[model samples]
Target: MTATALPRLCVVIPCFNEAANVAPMVARLDATLAGIAWEAIFVDDDSPDGTSVAVRAIAVQDSRIRCLKRIGRRGLASACIEGMLATSAPYLAVIDGDLQHDETLLPRMLEALEGGLAEIVIGSRNIEGGDKQGGLTAARQMISDTGAALANAALPMRVSDPMSGFFALPRDLLEEIAPRLTGTGFKILLDILLSAKRPLRSLEIPYSFRARVAGESKLDAAVLLEFAGLLADKALGGVVPLRFLSFAAVGAIGLLVHLAVLGLLHGLGGVGFNAAQWSATLIAMTVNFLLNNRITYRDRRLRGPALLRGLVLFYLVCGLGAAANIGIANLLLRDGVLAWGLAGAAGAALTVVWNYAVSATLVWRAK
Candidate 1:
């Protein structure tokens, strides 16, 4: 690739704390994309492990290597979106920063697009020639298989590996559907397939999923929850916001926490109704705050001093909601309008709307 020649294919790698893999990833791409004009863009989410620094060190020696360091923002889907938009390359591919995805498939994916075989090509492990045994552990494999099944049920087009992160598509098609993307979750490929206004022609290329040599795997139980949220967001056609759904789900869990604590204190310990209810409400509120930080506003998640400030602000913002909760439950209990369990649930339900509205605007509003 010459400095003056523009790349026909641009590979966007979204990274976080993958400093150890950046150099190896670049070298692999250089070796595989021999005669193709390709450039690599490493979009780092302000990784604490100095991922951006590593990319720059290589970029200084190779013009085809570049970096887009993002601070105060995170999420693989959004990172890939930003990196793809930053380039003028006609075709775009999204691969993991980890060495798991096959870099050699880039040329074939480009050929498929250029030959008009499909609008998008995915690197699939569920296909005949593909293998996931080398990379995913037993539990991780189970999660992937389950997620893909659920995703296929909701997707417009059937994909063997809807959860696969490795895929390539024309830049224009991406731009056409970019507005419809949720830009909030780990499964961007699923988001793309579901968001399209019309059915997209897609092909799957078989490849072995490689195990990680360095850095921790990001997959966890929380990721599955986020994946469900993405599907729910698409199903609703974006009429209801995704964050509100996540916030409401957390509120539902908080309600259970409230009841459990109330049952323990008032039912078993013989504590006064008023005192028990107040304690339960406070405890549930704290649980809701923590869960919301980790999931609902994850892209804008708080950390360090910011996390402390956010927690305090969350309590303050929900104070009115909590007050309403206590007042309503007391009224129902005093008037004997309902049983204690029913009364408590009624009050908690009222606060969901207030807390979601206020907390979103004040506590986790975009920084």
Candidate 2:
């Protein structure tokens, strides 16, 4: 390819802490995509291990290599979206930076798209020629299988591996559905398929899911929760924002905490009702703030001093929320309008709107 020639394909590798795999991934791409004009964009979420530096080192030597280092924000789906949008390449492929995904499938995926055989091509592990056992642990495999099953149930068309992260699609198709994408989790492929206005013409290619040669696997229990949030976000057709759904889910858990604490303090410890309620409210608010930081606003998660500051702000914000909660519950208790438990639940419910609205704007506002 000449220096002035435009790439026909752009491979977007969303990564963090995968510096060791950088050179090898580029070498693999160079070997496999011999006749193709392609570029590799490594979207690093400001990896502490200097993954961006590694990419830039190679990029200085090779024009086709590029680095997009994101600061103070992170998520695979969002990284891939940003990388894909950074290129003018006609076709876009998303492969992992950990080298678990087969880079060899890029050409095949591109062919399927260019030949009009598919609108989106997925490198599937569940297919006959593919293998997931090669890469995933037993627990991870089970999680993948269960998630695939659940995703397929909700998908417009049944997919053998809706959980597969390795996939490719036309840049135009991506642009078409980009506006609808939640860009919140690991399953960008699922987000793409679900967000499409019309059922996309799809093809699945078989590829062995390779074991990682460098960096730790980013998959965790939290990722599953994010996946669930993604499903909920799409299922509602984006009526309720994704972050709000996560906030509400955390709020539900907080309610459980509040009730448990209330029971322990008031029922078991013989504390006064008002005192127990206040104690439970404060404890629940703390739990909710921590969980919200870890999950709901994960991309904008605060750390160190910021986390401390955010916690203080959260307490102040929810303190007002708690006031409304206690006031309503006390009024109901005094008037005999409802049982204690029901009154408490109603008060908590009313405060969710207030806390979520205020906290989102004040505490977790993007930095």
Clashes of each: 0, 0
Total backbone clashes of model 2?
0
Shift in Å, residue 214, candidate 1? 1.4
> Which regions in candidate 1 have their CA more than 4 angstroms from the true location?
1-3, 303-308, 324-350
lDDT scores in order:
0.91, 0.91
Report the poorest 10 consecutive residues by lDDT, candidate 1: 1-10
Best by TM-score: 2
Judge candidate 1 at residue 292 and give its lDDT. 96
lDDT of candidate 1 over 1-367, digit per residue (tens) = 5458789999999999999999999999999999999999999989999999999999999989999998888888899999999999999999999999999999999999999999999999999999989898898889899999998888778899999999999999999999989888788898889888777899999999998899978767888899988988888888898888999999889889999999999999999999999999789888988999998887787889988898888888788887898899999999999999999889877878778888888888876
Clash pairs for candidate 2: none
RMSD of each: 3.4, 2.9
Give me candidate 1's TM-score against the actual structure.
Answer: 0.91
